[model samples]
Target: MTEQLPDTISRLYADPGEYVDSDHPAVEAFARAAVPSDASARDKARRLYTAVRDGIRYNPYVSMRSPESYRASSVLAAGNGYCVGKAALYAAACRVHGIPARVGFADVRNHLTTEKLRQSMGSDLFTWHGFTEVFVDGAWRKATPTFNDTLCAKLGVKPLDFDGHADALLHPFDGEGRAYMQYVNDHGSYHDVPAKFLMREMAREYANMQGEDLAGRDMEREATEQ
Candidate 1:
């Protein structure tokens, strides 16, 4: 039986925010094409999770200076984005199908990162790492679709998958038992991408990240080289 969603929860699927523009034509079409319309909520969420996860190449080198970088439709059109943008895309896609979803943020110490990226940020601690909180089966399940399967394979870590029932967070250890990602703190969830606030926090945290156009840099190639 489908559980009754409260007004607050229902509102999550309503208006299309500046970033999470679910009502956009392209986003709606993408969501509809990802799964059959008659699929269960869990099935829909699961399909959407994988669609955004692998469909969008995870590229951390992209510039965060523009507000358009964080917008879901723009991210989808670009074919690549960082964690936050991918999360926003997933949330927007889910909302297109009436699945209540929100973007969640956290600070993680990533052990398996490119040396160039680490130097660029001056630290391995990634702030505002984004994931999606999907409401399924009367509970909010966390899904981290940031690292695609191909990248995880190259990094020697298991690909994060969503079962639509459990939280799909990053693994703390790699296949060889080496330390991987350590979640330091969580910044809670939001209905839409807090673009300005995230950019401000990112600028404050990563001194070298602001206003830099890092296009054409292949993060996957860097990972393979490392």
Candidate 2:
């Protein structure tokens, strides 16, 4: 049985934020279409998780300076985004179904990144790696819909899955048994995208990202080359 949410955490189901615009028409429609109206909370969460995970492609080559880059609706319309945008979209979709959800951030060392991406970021340590946290079955469960199936196939990594009951974090090793991702630091969870703080920290950490035009670059192509 699903447990009741406390007063403090109930606000997570309140109106959407600037980034996680769950009230947007597209997000609402997408969420509704992903699951049946009679579906239970866990079923809805599982369906929405997979819909966002595979429906939208994961593309790391995007301009971080643009606000639209982080907006959930924009990410859905564009059909691609990095971890942050994808997480925002997943949270937004969950909210549309009256599910309490939030975005979580962590610093992870990606040991299996492509060379061009490694050079672009200047390090394999990715800060603000985003994931979705949904309150289901009486607990806040983490769900990472970052790496899509196609990209994971190209990179020889298994796609992350969400069971709506357990945390779906990144794997510690790839298919070849090589080290893949390691969580170094956690930034906790937020009801909305902390855009200003996130951009400020990102600017301070990644000097090359400022004014960098990452257009036309394809992460899938790079993964295939590796």
Please, what is the TM-score per model? 0.94, 0.95
Tell me the whole-model lDDT of each prediction, alpha carbons only.
0.89, 0.90
User: What are the root-mean-square deviations of the candidates from the true structure over C-alphas?
Assistant: 1.9, 1.6
For residues 1-226, could you state the per-residue lDDT of candidate 1 as single tens digits?
Answer: 4466788767855457789999989999999999999999999999999999999999998777778779999999999999999999999999998888889999999997888788788899999999998888988889998988898888888888898988898998998999999999999999889999888887799878664557678888998887
Model 2 weakest 10-residue run by lDDT:
6-15
TM-score between model 1 and native: 0.94
Best by lDDT: 2
- lDDT string for model 2 (64-171, tens) is 766777899999999999899999999999999888999999999999989999998999999999999999888888999999899999999889888888889999
lDDT of 1: 0.89
lDDT of 2: 0.90
Off by over 4 Å in 1: 1-4, 211-213
- Tell me the lDDT of model 1 at 100: 86
